[model samples]
Target: MNKKRLGPCVTFFPQPTTLVSTIAADGEVNVMTASWAGIVSKTPPTMAVSLHAGRKSYDNVKQSGEFVVNMVPASLAVEADYCGV
Candidate 1:
């Protein structure tokens, strides 16, 4: 018997896209697309989303003290990509 060998995987993109919403203290809102997110504390319904520090959404989230994470559907991929920009 012969088995094909594949090298060890490094990174994968298996998560659904998300539109993270945040607002500044002055009520300015910002949204950004993210895939590096998952449940951290299920009982409390908390999750962590990764983003670069320079992003407006990051600043908004820190300033606002809260955020809304919206899941992106397959039908909305195009729009989601657009929204991230």
Candidate 2:
């Protein structure tokens, strides 16, 4: 087997798209589409999500210390795309 170098880049196939919902301390609700999330542990049933500091979802999570991750179906692709944007 031969391995070719492909320079530094992030490449992960079929990353699942999820909807993350959060509510701020002021009762402000926000939902954002995220692909940068995955399971980190199985025994404890833990998962991880990545969000930019400037994003509302990040702030909401910080303020509330909670969030909900929802799996998106193929039928809602259009809505998911809109949310991601």
Candidate 3:
């Protein structure tokens, strides 16, 4: 029998820059630029985000369970980063 070897360690970005926009029950919409969202469950197509407690988007997420995740390319990275503000 022959044994196979794996390559050395490598680092890479997991996801593209994404801007998540959410709206509260009062219709106040907020956008947050995030690079830390991941799939939480495959069964329901759920996603998890690492949002701080004080963010506007965080409040929106709590008020409304729906949000849109928009991916950004390098050309639009600066614009996407500004969405959180």
> Per-residue lDDT for 15-80 in model 2, tens only?
677899999898877899987888899999988989889999998888889999988888887888
Query: Compared to the true structure, candidate 2 yields what TM-score?
Result: 0.81
Selected candidate, larger lDDT, 1 vs 3: 1
Report residue 1 deviation for candidate 3 (angstroms). Answer: 39
How many residue pairs collide in each prediction?
Answer: 0, 0, 0
Predicted structure 3, TM vs. truth? 0.65
- Quick one: ranking by lDDT, best first? 2, 1, 3
lDDT by residue (tens digit), candidate 3, 38-62: 7789998887777877888877887
Clashes of 3: 0
lDDT of each: 0.83, 0.86, 0.79
lDDT (tens digit, per residue) of candidate 1 on 31-71: 88986888899898888888788988888877767889898
How large is the C-alpha RMSD of every model relative to the true structure? 3.1, 2.8, 6.3
The TM-score between candidate 1 and the true structure equals: 0.76
Question: Would you estimate the TM-scores of all the predictions?
Answer: 0.76, 0.81, 0.65
Ten residues in a row with the worst lDDT in model 3? 5-14
Most accurate candidate by lDDT: 2
